[model samples]
Each structure stands twice: as C-alpha cells, then as structure tokens.
Target: MDEIATDNRQGILTRIRWKAGYMNPALRRIADRVLKAPDEIKAISIKDLALQCEVSESTVTRFVREIEVQSFQHFKILIAEELSQGSSSTPPITDRHVYEDITDQDDTASVLSKVAARYAMTVADTRAGLPAEALEKAVLAIEEADVLGFFAMGASLLCVENALLRFMRVGKRCLFFRDLGIRKFSISTLGPKSLAVGVSNSGRSISTVDSLRQAKAQGTTTLAITSFPDSPIVRHADICLFTPTVTGVIGPAEYHESMVSKIAQLQVIDVLYSLYAVRNFGRAIEGLERTSDVTALTRY
Candidate 1:
C-alpha cells in the first residue's frame, strides 16, 4: 500500500497524472475525469461514468482494476478520503523494511523479526486476494478429476510438492515431473477427466504454461494459481486463482527471495486440502489413519 498526502487538494490529480501516460486511451479518459473533477465523479454510477468516458461498462471495470482499486465503489471511497483529508498531512502507513535482503551485519534477532513479519503480511494479503468462488470451483474440479497433474518450475515446484504430499493422503491420483521432458509426456496422458494445475506466480513460466496449454488441448480442465491474472497462463486456464504480488513496500522484484510467493501458493493448497477433506471427512480420516498405522510399524 502507498501513502496519501492528507492536505493536498490535488492528490487524486497527482496520482492520475503520475499514471496517465501508462494508461491506454480508455483508462486515461476515466483517470482524467477522476483527477479533474473528483467530487462529481464520486457521485456518479459506473454506467454513467462509462457513458461519460465514451467506453463500455466493462472498460470502466478494467479501469478500476488497472488503477488497483478493488472496485468503482472502492475508488470513490479513496476519492472521498482524499477530499476529507483536505489540509492535514499524515504519517506514512507503511515501513521501508518490506522485501529486504539479508546482509552480513544482520543478527539472529533482526532475521527472526523480518522473517516473521514478512510471513504475516504474505499470508494476510494472499488470503485477501484469493477469489472464493474460483477456489470452490478449483476444489470441485480436483475432486472430480480422474487424475491431478501439477506443473511448476524452479522454486515454484516446491509449492506443488507440498500440495502433492497432502492431496496424496486423500486417496486421489496425483502426478508431477521434475524433468521438463517427462512432465510434458505426463501431461499428454491426461484427458477430460483430468485436472492440470499450473503453479506460477508470474504466470509466464514456459514449461508451466506449455503444460497447461497441452492439458487444455487434451480437454483437461486447467486451473492456474498465479499472481498475474492477465498473464499467458490465464489464457490457457479454465479457471484462474490470483495471489498477492507481495514484493515489498518499495516495489522490489517479482517476489521476495525468502519465497513469499511460495507461502502464498502453499496457503491455497492448504485451503483446498481442508475443503476437500471436510467434504469427504469419513474417507479422508480413514485414509489418513490407515497410512499412519502402516508407517508407524516401520517408524518403530
């Protein structure tokens, strides 16, 4: 989150001007009106705003998302907040410690504190960003699939492995491949009854996207768990679940080196596993207990 200038009358104008050049023609028109006449625009409906901008209602929706406001109502709330803050400057609400890299000078206390806070924010933002309807649909798809194939690359691969460990216990057929060539072969074997999950935060991983593409081609339902909704992976996915792009307060890289995206991805897995187990608790408990009992003999 960014700070607002409390006393500035033209804060909205400044924000629009800052992002205007980056926006296309349609979004620019929307931004211009909000910047030039914040009070009037705040009172208008989205339909009226679309007519004023000479764009479709959908374009207005896209503009709101482009501006990173959750909705048109949310954008108006921000404008109202700006108006209410007329002349008093407030302290920035965030810290500069986000996505910080570790250094030789750091001690155990600093490392622990930074790591804890980062996980806290990462989990919170991920929870907020996950679309509930999409999540339910993904869980249902997995439950109905004859086999579930997970596709991931590099560090992202670990997130899917975490899912594999949990999903396997539910007595469902799950599959993956560490080798890219082998992975594609496995994807080719899936059909309409299969579900392919492409796990990529950026959604541009060639191997992961390619796997989803092939899976879709075979009539398998594809689910994308990513931070980017507009990424190539989304095009191939039948359903898309977004995660928060939590790099840092200062706009760092795609994700933190400590694997905040991994945390986000794992959280989705946790939710899915929980939902699936609850839906089939009797079978889930039996499977878990049977596995536990079998493994316990070897453990002793």
Candidate 2:
C-alpha cells in the first residue's frame, strides 16, 4: 500500500472491492455496505456507520485505511466525488444474464433495456476503476518493448488476438501464440526488453497463469488485464489494468458467461490501442499505409 490509489476523480469503491479479498470480515462488511448504499452512507456519520455495521469506531477507521485512504473523512470525500459524477444508489444485479432471470414472460423491450443497462454500467465501472498511472506505464511499456506477447484462452483469446493485429498494423512487433504447448516456450524466450500482455476475464485461465508465471521468471515485463484484481494471474504481473464485470451473478448464486464482461475487456483494449497510436502518430500512419495498400485493390 506504499503507492496510495487516490480517486483519479472517477470513483473509488470499485477499487476498494479490487482489494476486498484481503480485508477482514468487518472491513469487508463496511466495503459492501458502502457500495450497496452509497447515498445512505454519504449521509451517515463515521460513528453511526460503525454502529450500523455493528463494529467499533476504530474498526470503521481501519476499514478506511484498508482501502488506503488517510482517514475516514478522506474516504468519504472520495465517495462524495464519485457521487457528484451522478451515480446515486447502487443498481441491483438482476437481469445481468439473458438466461438466468429472463423468461418467456419477459417482453422484448424489457430484455433490450436490461441488457443495454448492464453493458453501459460495466463499461462505466471499468472506466472508473482505471488507474491513470498504471495505464500510462502499460502503454509506454508496449510502445518501447522489442516485442509484445499476447496470452489468453477461450473468449479472452479474441481480445488478445485483436490487440496483436492492432499493434502489428501500427508497426509494433507483436506475438500471438495460440497453441498451449508452445505458449510457455514462447514466454520463456522473452526477457527484460519485451512486454507480455495477458488477457483473462476470470483471471484464472490455466494458460494465462502459466504463461505469466514464465514471463515473470524470465524477467519480462508483465501486464494482466482482468476483472479480478486479486486473482492468481495478478501475482505474476508487474502491473495490472482491471476491467469491470458482472461478477456477483457468477458461481453458486447462478452461472453464465457475461457479454458485458467481454465488452468491458474490449474497452480496455481500445484504450491501450488509442493511447499508443496517439503517442506514435507518424509510425502508426506509416504502418497503416503499408498494410492498407496490400488490401486496397481487393476493395474495388
């Protein structure tokens, strides 16, 4: 917690949940209540919050420090900043999936609206959780690396491969090793001059975990793009960019892969690509011209 993550003026609760797994039960309860009822929490005093959460006043103070804020007042200030951005009460997690809560009785318009709301919130939350300093370092690492290795499995593979093509078209050396057998070998080839970017929506992909582990072992700079900041994949990363998702709907509560999760990860992909392209305008244009010329005649 040496580098405190202050609100880059977007939001801070999601970032608090990012490290929630390590929090004690009392602190975790406080974190949950803050996210569950932001507006109410805003109106309550610290002592009242302690009483409400059934913890002592000092426990309330500990919850604030667990999230890295200097004091309870500072933590509330960050919450106020987020609320000023227009999200009042927390939204319920219903209708996050088409199959789970949806039924034949549901109308078409209702289905469309709920799905749209889910996507909108997922992107908004992910954007809020982004740490500008970490994003800057990730972009600069990719831009300066001798090569960038893309690692992923299942649905996340598409996002990583898309990143490879985007970086390649912009004149960057990018690697895409789709076969699991060769993935670790390829990872071992990288060193201090390379960047290994692993995309894992769950942050528990076997291929992703092993590849990132090898990348770290070889001294390659590693970046993990995931929804779970405290997941195993993060253990091997030099830096991490967190994505937001419908995590509450997963596991024994109910189960399904979320479309919003994939879209959120893609938003991170687009952010990285946009930042790199802006930073290297001339080279990007040159590479685009070279690639477009080869396919230009086919387009008529």
Candidate 3:
C-alpha cells in the first residue's frame, strides 16, 4: 500500500538509481544511459533515448513506470526541474562508477575500507528509500498481532532469526521454521489476528513469495522486507518495506544475495523492533528483565 512520493525530482531520481542495478538487462542499459546523461535525457525524445540505449521504445516507457513515475514526459519534466536548480548542489549517483569489487590483489586495509563504505551506503540508501508510513504500519501490525511468524530462506534467514530473538525477548509470541514444509504448515494455522513477515533480499525466492501469498489467503496480515520494490513478493504483502539494492550496484554476479544486502535488511528489522518496543515500553522492559535474569544464571 505504500507508494513513493513522486512530487520531487530527487525522489524520482533516487528511485531510479536504487533500482537500476536490479532492473532486467534491457532496462539496466536504459538506466545506465539516463543516469550518466540526465541533461542529455531531458532534451532527448523517448524514441531517441530508446535508439541510443539499443532498446525498444516500449522498454523506455516501462523504465519510467518502474521508477514509479506517471509517464515519460513527467519523467523528463522532473529531470528538467532538477537541472534548472542551477546550484548543482545535488549530484546524481550514476555520474561516476564508484562501486568497486574486491580482488585477489587487495590488501586487508583495502578490503576493510571498501566493505565499510559499502555498509555505510547500504544503511543510508535503505533509510532514504524506506517509506515512513509503511514502516509505521508494520510496527503497529507487529504490536497488535496475537502471534508473529517470520519467513525467509538462505542468508535472508539471518534477519528472520534476529527478529525472532528480539521480539521474543520482549515477550511477544513468535515462530520461525527452517523447514519449508513446516513453514507452510505453520502459515496455514495463522488467522486474521496473526502477522506473517517475509524477508528476502532478491524478493523472488519462490518459498518466501509463496509463503506470503499463502498467508494472505489465510486472512493474516502480510508484510515483506525486500530490496526490489516491484518484485514478485510485493504482490502478496499487505505492508511492504524495501531495502536498497547494494549487490545490484556492486556486481560480480556472485554477490547478488551478499552480506552487504543483509546489513540493509537487518537495519529494517532493528528499526521495526525498536519501534515495537517503544510502543509497549512497560511490558517490553519487564519482559527483558525477566529474560535477562533467567539467562544470567547460564553465564559463567
């Protein structure tokens, strides 16, 4: 239900930049050209832009809608406004190719710096792109739900497990299953008062998407945490939270679901958990105290 605000040029451009990496090969070609030459794009017609990108004119139209704009003219209008600002205070992300890949020749210091920068950008982009109203709705849904179910596969499960621990520590009833069959079966039991949260970096994982779809069929509120806004997972979610496309930007093809993306997903989980706790402060505090006291006895 959350929609990106398209009133400003920055919003339109930011969405394009964030989603460029994940777009299909044809769209990426178009996106790459647009970002590198926004000034040129403003003056060029859609037919010309398509010819330059070597894609069809329809693909150009699809790219505009993919960025959530109403039409190509609208897209060009926003770009013109951005250029007319005259200050050049804000620069487009695509102006240069800065995302670097780690190589065999890299030193520890180089790896550390590159990775640190990647994480920093992931956090910032995720924060900027995430919809405020969607987040608020997710937090409220978690707080009101009689029970919570977290679903995910592969590295994305890290976010699911983390949420399971954090929310459970605050005395909320939650469930997670590593087994696909168990997950599907458990989802079937959830009713209108329950919430189903699916975490997927690519948002195309069949297990995760189908789980959300199944949950929705059961009348449970569904939420999705993913990097792709237009992904298959969004169709099934009642509320959706999006992370920035980190792996898409820094590509070696193998890093599609890398830890860099996980950092963004985890950040979303941390914010959701924090907000839920604040809303039920007294109960959450008391639950934390009790859990801490019990766990303390296990410590050496």
TM-score-better candidate, 1 vs 3: 3
Could you give candidate 3's per-residue lDDT for residues 1-300 as a string of tens digits? 133243362245546756664468899898878767677888899999999999999999999887777889988987777556533533344443333356555688988998887787777767767767778999999988999988899999899888988999999999888988888899877999999999987788999999999999889999998866557898899988877653432122223456778888889999999998998999999999989987798899
Clashing residue pairs found in predicted model 2: none
Residue runs of model 2 more than 4 Å from their true location after superposition: 1-15, 19-105, 249-256, 297-300
Ranking according to TM-score, highest score first: 2, 3, 1
lDDT of each: 0.74, 0.75, 0.78
Off by over 4 Å in 1: 1-109, 248-258, 297-300
For residues 1-300, could you state the per-residue lDDT of candidate 2 as single tens digits?
323443432246656756554456788788778866776766689989988889999999988776657877778767776666544333344524355345555699978887777677677767756778878989999887999998998888778867877888899998877778888678777889999998887788888988898898888999998766557998999888877563442123113555567887888888999899999999999999999977687786
lDDT of 2: 0.75
lDDT of candidate 2 at residue 133, scale 0 to 100: 82
Clashes of each: 0, 0, 0
Give candidate 3 misplaced runs (Cα > 4 Å): 1-14, 17-100, 249-255
lDDT of 1 by residue, 1-300 (tens): 342222122234334443443467888888777755677875899999999899999999998776556677877877777655642333244523344444554689988986887678667656654657777898899889999999999778888988888888778789998988898789888999999999997788899999999899889999988765446898899987766643421222244333767888899889999999998899888878878876688775
lDDT value, residue 260 of candidate 2:
65
Task: Give the number of the best model, judged by lDDT.
Answer: 3
Model 3 TM-score, 2 decimals = 0.70
